[model samples]
Target: MLSGAAAQDSAASATGATPVAGTAASALIGVSVDPSAVPDSTAGAESSGSARRELVSATGSATQPGGDAATATAAVVDGSGASAASAGAAVGARHSASTVGGDSVIPPDSHDTVVILLPEMPAMDAPGALEAAAEFFANPTWLPDLAGVRDCWLVTVGGEQVTSGDPVPHQFHGAVTAGFRCLGMESLGVSFRRVDLAAGQADASRAAALVRAVHVKNEPELALRDGAVYAKRLEIDAVQRGPARDADLAHVVIVGGTGTLGVEFCAHYARSGAGRITLLSRSGETAEVTRRLRPIRALGDTPIIVESCDVTDADAVVELAERQEIPATVLVHAGVNYVRAELAEVTPEKFREMAGSKIYGTEHMLHTWPRTPDCRIVLCSSAAATFGGRGQILYATVNRMLDVLARRLRAAGVDAVAVQWGLWDLEGPLHAVGTGPVQAAGVTPMRAADALAVGFTDHADHSGAENRLVAAADWSDVQALMVAIGQGPLLDDVVAAAAESAVVQPDSPGSGHRDGNSPRIAGTPADGHRGTADSAAYPSGPDRVRATVAQGGTKAMTQFRAAAGQPGAAGGNSANLAERVRRQLGRVMGADADALDPSVPLVALGLDSLQALDFRKRVQVELDRDLPVAAILGGASLDDVVRLMAGSQA
Candidate 1:
């Protein structure tokens, strides 16, 4: 967080605004300035003009006024050249003031514009900083005349730092900027640009040119790097390369050592000839912790120490590091407090707790650990950081922060690597939520051993990279999901590989059968079902749909379709079709068919992506018609889906 004076100066420099003698121009342009920072002579200047008086007198106190503050602020500027402090004070004073005559003051010109410049802040401060920024810019009291403001520029600093491998966190900044851009465009009808200025290079001409480029191109994110402005784009490369040899693991320290992944890491390192292993966790030496660590202890005769320490606490980490007689050669920061909830549903407290466990824990561990070029730091991040999963925004953000931290450490000559791992086939958070949604996204859950092996090998040689994504994925399913989400271009190579492999192996598992009935899509079961001899023994019609839905996936669809002579057996009548659809959906969602609301989207009733694919397949098989994957997962209600199915039968 920048000091008030520094923030004002930085904002002014970035916007090419010449600062007044006593009043900062940046404050007028929307960067927050401390009232105390203003000179007494300038602060004492009475706000002049009808616009200023109306704005100040409209609200009697320093509280948010009910209407368009932006228009009112613009009117003040139009009416008189009142200093920023005076304007701010007048606006601040209006919080308690009521309308002078109960008629809202109208600005002389609605075209008046306001430019908001957000100063540089640490990456961890992004969430709170953005919230504060949003409140300031969008607040009714601050901008009662919101219509007057047409453009918003969030001035973010750190383009050079990111390129130079400095630890300046930009992922969170980008995410927050994206959110604000959407909000500004949709809610405020404001054109928003996240302008990144390089450090020590915020000249007026460069800043002006960058802003012009961004405005002209309508780019949401633009960065000034090495005096050249560039638009930020996300791209993915699918490269096939052999893994590097595993690194030596002699003396190791595992944070969050009692957690599932932590224990797995300890066991793997122990097996890999780690001489001494120290486990740090808040749980300390509880019976549960001991039970979890017993197997790892038996893995080898490695000396293991279990200690209670919260990695989030700086003092605890420093004390532990100082107390250790034998310094660790490798530090594995695997700490994470998982919370699964939609972005809107996540409470600030929950976000803090989750972020604290990883972000703060990593900072504390890194800063306190003895720094040596020979030492290795392994940050256990998740695939969510790379490919965001549903209800894991905060999870992804923190993991991304770790990735940045690893790069920063690596740039500082430390052997640090961040491993963005996929879902492990273990009883962890994903399992608790039912891994159907993630599996539907085409990520195959890797066994812990396999995951560790890949991670260790891939990250062993990080001379060219600080982060590596290691996960088992079904490329075909992955490609389908990416295409559905309009990000097919990112995985062009993966799609090509999937197509090439299909041509090479026509009879591959999960591939479409010789019959044209089975269309290859996401969430297909690994094994394709072959027709049974006793076809007549199977159920038919709505009963068949219900049975197949309960059975789950493409295999169920295949078996039921083969049994029901003609797949359209269930399409006898509209009422029968509706009932079958409801029952089938209910079965997949573990809900009661009678209780399910037909007007609600399937996703609202807990139908995840994978289940949606399965449900679509079942419907196609039962009704003998094709169902687009989008109709099921794209928030189409039950009634809408039923109508589509009925129309397809016609």
Candidate 2:
């Protein structure tokens, strides 16, 4: 088993420090040296479903090239390491001579470097890749093998594994890069080579040549044919701002086209003069397809076709792409399976389902692309990939893969980009479900037009760049959230630049802050009239009774009235309060406020228990009523709750 000192050494290596046998942290551990990749599309491991296991328990030693085999005993739990059982008794292959004390003996005519492809766990394997990852991290004995090597090339094959922030994946990448560095690999004149097998080009001769030709720079960077590796530093300040470019997207295809954001994209493209836009979704039913197409049809005479298609199905995607009359010049991957739940609530199947549309779907799309050149794929990733919000671990992981995939694609000479968007004002399928939680946190929602402009105009123009993180939020707020979630160090200079540009100009005409030089609409209105007062003008029904309560108004009133028992306005009394409750319920239930029958069970209006709880909390705070949590449980309706409040008052 690895000692605590070894863990400290691994951490120190990440920061370019020498690993001592037993030492407290004497040096700072830097952020991951190389970007990480997302987990592959393997079957859900049993360990992923259970509580996370410590990496130290999985520790085992690996054999060096010249040394006796230590018989590494740990099993692979994540994608970073291999299982000793599956790998057989043999360890790494022997090369040049080296000693445990960090001395080297190399012949005059040798390659001077060793390249190792990071192995992943097969889906059917036991103790899983995650377990293997734990074991690898626990000991990482092979790190000592690089003691005397001139250089080491750690080839990461899948793009998905390159930029992951999830704990297991992050630990695996750290163990490989920093773990090796701490083992005194650098002391032996070893330089690091991160060979990304872009677009599955490993079998191609050109790819092999590219790997052989890589040379490490004097700094902490690597190079391939003079082109620097793509990182946030390279493209962080590269967002193009101005009018939308007339992109030559004669034929554009959108996956997950039946959602609201899909239709919005179709509208934006139609306005941008896309020749023919085809939307693909799994639901082939006529009514569902028609509902999805309604907004697209509203966008004047552009030919918008709706077809039933599943992006996750490789054969179906290939067949559809093959049959397109005009070769698809652009493909937009907007497909996602959104599920927001706590870590403990997530099941292995749910994890797989969440990953299907983004991971498997993007992979299939890339593989099934027509051989025709100039074709580009644009993946719509989310900010969750970066900041990682509560109950969104799986969603964040999936989005992160999009960014990594773009990196791999570009490295492989493909025209691709992944745009990591913040919360958008236009409610897409994922947005519709996730907006509540996002707002509860403090991220400002980006406007629809601005969002489209950022994606199509800003990011699309920068074809050379791989990943673009686009979000309009206060730097302080974002920093606070990141700090709360333990991801502060990941924030780069780009975030600082964005934060500086987004400083609130109270004197500015519009309430929205400027991103760089361009002004973006802030989530809250400029006049500070975001609540019921502003909503009063846009009242939907004849009664005109439901105005949006300004944010925090309800909470303030609840505290005041609950503590002091002060009588409020007549409209705030129980009678009108009941009407307000019914109206809010109607909004949640997707029914007309004036037309809703207060006697009917809210469950009949599509509210489950959790949703009902959400509604109940809103009412309790808004009206300052001392309502029991279960008041809305069982067959309770608006009238039942109103009567209960009245009875409590008497």
RMSD of each: 18.6, 20.3
What lDDT tens digits, residue by residue, belong to model 1 across residues 1-650?
01111111010000011111211111000011111111224222111100110111112221222323232222222121212333343234433211111133445345333333333445444335334333332332322244544444455555223232233444444344433332331222344445566554443434333323333223334454443444332211111112333555567888987778888888877866788888899978888878877887888799888999988889988888888887767888877567765534546555566677677677777778664557788888776654555566556655656665665565567777777777776777668768777766555565564355445532333233335555545433443344333223333422332222211012344332233322112121112211111111121222211000001122323333433444533536778878877877777677888999999877678776567655654555555544444455555789988787666455
**TM-score, predicted candidate 2 vs. hidden true structure:** 0.47
Candidate 1 deviant stretches above 4 angstroms: 1-248, 286-295, 460-465, 475-489, 502-611, 616-650
Going through the candidates in order, what is the number of backbone clashes in each?
A: 20, 24
What is residue 78's positional error in candidate 1, in angstroms? 20
Over the stretch 482-575, how does candidate 2's per-residue lDDT look in tens digits?
3322222234332332222221222354333224333222223222221111111112333321111112222323433552444652234667
For model 1 the local lDDT of residue 126 reads: 34
In terms of lDDT, model 2 sits at 0.43
Using lDDT as the measure, which candidate wins?
Answer: 1
